[model samples]
Target: MEHQSENKDMNHEFLPMTSVANNTGDQVAPGVFVLTTKIVNVYFIQCSEDPSTYYLVDAGMPKSGDMICEWAEKWFNHPPKAILLTHGHFDHVGAVNDLAEKWQVPVFAHHEEIPYLNGQKDYPKPDPSVNGGLVTKLSPMFPNHGIDLGSRIQPLPEDGTVPGLAGWKWIHTPGHTPGHVSFFRENDRVLIAGDAFITVKQESLYQVMTQKQELNGPPKYFTTDWKLAEKSVQTLAALEPSVAATGHGIPMNGSKLKEGLPHLAQNFNELAVPDHGKYVD
Candidate 1:
């Protein structure tokens, strides 16, 4: 397939943000690897039944396409068969267009997210009025525009099967975005949680820069519907995932996840939802 064009925002300037984990990668599961690009994460998952098969989940920050490709080549020794998106957020899909064209592979996303990926709609604007710290204060600078993926983007299979990665299902974990989804491998209970629930206090600059490991809701500035976001967190927490790698912050598991996830779910309104924000009801 000829990818004759680029995403409209491919040239967007990189945001001035970094964490201690930037450019670092770690194995969160037998075949699941997480790479931090600036402050966001993109995953490389290897199929359980096939050692040579792998897929990229979520493209990282803007201008990080080459970095992601290099990491993939070094570790997997081959390009992925497909790229799976948890959502169409700017940070998550930043390198998607370039990566798809370079690898000549398909990009799969939830059907609800197709409009944003196809350039038909823009996400709700970020609300800096949300309660938080420097990161939240700087929210308005983050891009909320959608990029055109043209023919390379396709809706994921309705059956929940992830295209190239076997033994996993995509869960509709919206609220962070209307179409936001999380990947779960039932057998091991490993979750690629997108921004449904992250490990860092994304709205706090210090927490973000230091990569503090704390269970928190989606970035408050970008989350439009607290009700749905709350429901989404409840959904994932009930799954009792043994391990989870989110869009930001470090991969969290064991006691932290066990205690924190439930706590966050049980007290979402008090904890995750901002008391007031432009998007908050």
Candidate 2:
């Protein structure tokens, strides 16, 4: 199945963001794959031996569930054993309820994110006033309410163990969301950096549309705590990921990742954080 066209009937209104996105369906490593949604991304962690036993990194935009499943079938000819989340945002969890039900798999997220994922809490409103561009301006209308995933959702293992994938650990990268996380594999230095950091300049309509590759912090409008966010970037950069893909923008690696990561972590105040926003101190 082809990716669905952009989701326009949502309660939230993002005028310019399209429904279909550039599917960066490429093999980053021997067992890792990346797939793009309208303006976000999801990952497929395939098992070399067991097609039925694998993992999904994050869920994508509202109506992109079929695209995700198709991407899985294309790569491994089967479904995943579980759905792991980085946080509970509309863009990231939009397709979660559907996919988790379809695959009959548990949805795992950081313990802190349970409130938002279980209909117990709502995220603070996005600061559209933050300096970025149209996307930032429209951010206020974006959905901040929690989804009711019911019994299908659970917290990631407290021991940092990833359920279906070996050698991967979930890092507590808060600030984007109280429970945001990024995945890492020390042996290969492969990082699946959720929104704790992203590769696109999310504030700009132009750059986000073009999928420009840049090392930017979490999307400015939605990020609530700058200090913790900065610390998270420093944490991921210290890992020195050889190849990295994020929630937004395209995949990046080599010198760009090597040089860009440290630079972003060191200079996030000026390079990534905005000057003014409700959450900004």
Candidate 3:
């Protein structure tokens, strides 16, 4: 799978009047809808037990608080129970502070990510030299700073249970980040695969902007642990998810997803991992 894209300005889509195509607040499963704000994604999940209860997954990019709130109000019938984080990347945690305060809700993350969320640490610098297009080249400018959410943020429970979603489990899919996780529903085999693996070839400019659907690994530039990332992919593939929504690109299902996921798992090093990067051995 190789790309020969015609689009060039993928990151500039967030600019005013840029005419970017958005699939914000689209339901990918019976209860999962992904809210895309530019190149990043946040999810709105409804609990099967109570129609009036829900949770917001990942807060989206900085300054996206208003846009995310607007989408939630327009699409979801009930207020969120809490804010669950897959990880604390700048893009993923951008609007967290604003949303947590406005909703008066607690934010939950893997215990390993607490230091980053509380401004105690920063992720390793992004690898601009990774085998990617403009996105990797420009990643050096992306924020490496952490957000200080104060006492509003807490760790996800260690019992594998998702706060409000009784049937769901938060799998420890670390690699991209030490505490990164993916949410799974065993009965339906549906997955919300934060950045553990995405449905788009994030290194390519056109793929991110066009929202192309390809079962690929995490973003190579930001992923600091290739071996662990590879293991995470295999673990997710083992679940045999019938449908999946990722942090980037479009949600996918059916034969396309079934066949693509296993292929990605089997050949991750060749297809997903970059040959030379700061994070690569």
Task: Encode model 2's per-residue lDDT on 146-264: one tens digit a residue.
Answer: 99999998988999988867778999999999999998887877789999888889989898888767789999999999999999999999998887768887767767788999999
The reply for model 3, stretches above 4 Å from the true place, is 1-20
> Which scores better on lDDT, 1 or 2?
1
Per-residue lDDT over 1-281 for candidate 1, one digit per residue giving the tens place of the 0 to 100 score: 11112212212321222454558766667678778998899998888788677899999889999999888877777789899999998999999999999999999999999999999999988999989999989988999999999999999999998876778999999898999999999997889999999988999888888887889999999999889999999999999988878999888877788889999999999999998987887
* Candidate 2: clashing pairs of residues: 6-19
Lowest summed lDDT window (length 10), candidate 2: 7-16
Which candidate number would show the highest TM-score if scored against the true structure?
1
lDDT of 3 by residue, 2-99 (tens): 11123222222211212125535556677676778888889887788985678999998888998888877776644589999999998899999989
Which segments of model 2 are wrong by more than 4 Å? Answer: 1-24, 48-52
TM-scores across all candidates? 0.92, 0.90, 0.91
79: Cα error in model 1, Å: 0.8
Name the top lDDT candidate: 1
- The TM-score of candidate 3 is 0.91
Candidate 3, residue 145: the lDDT equals 77
Best to worst by TM-score, what's the order? 1, 3, 2
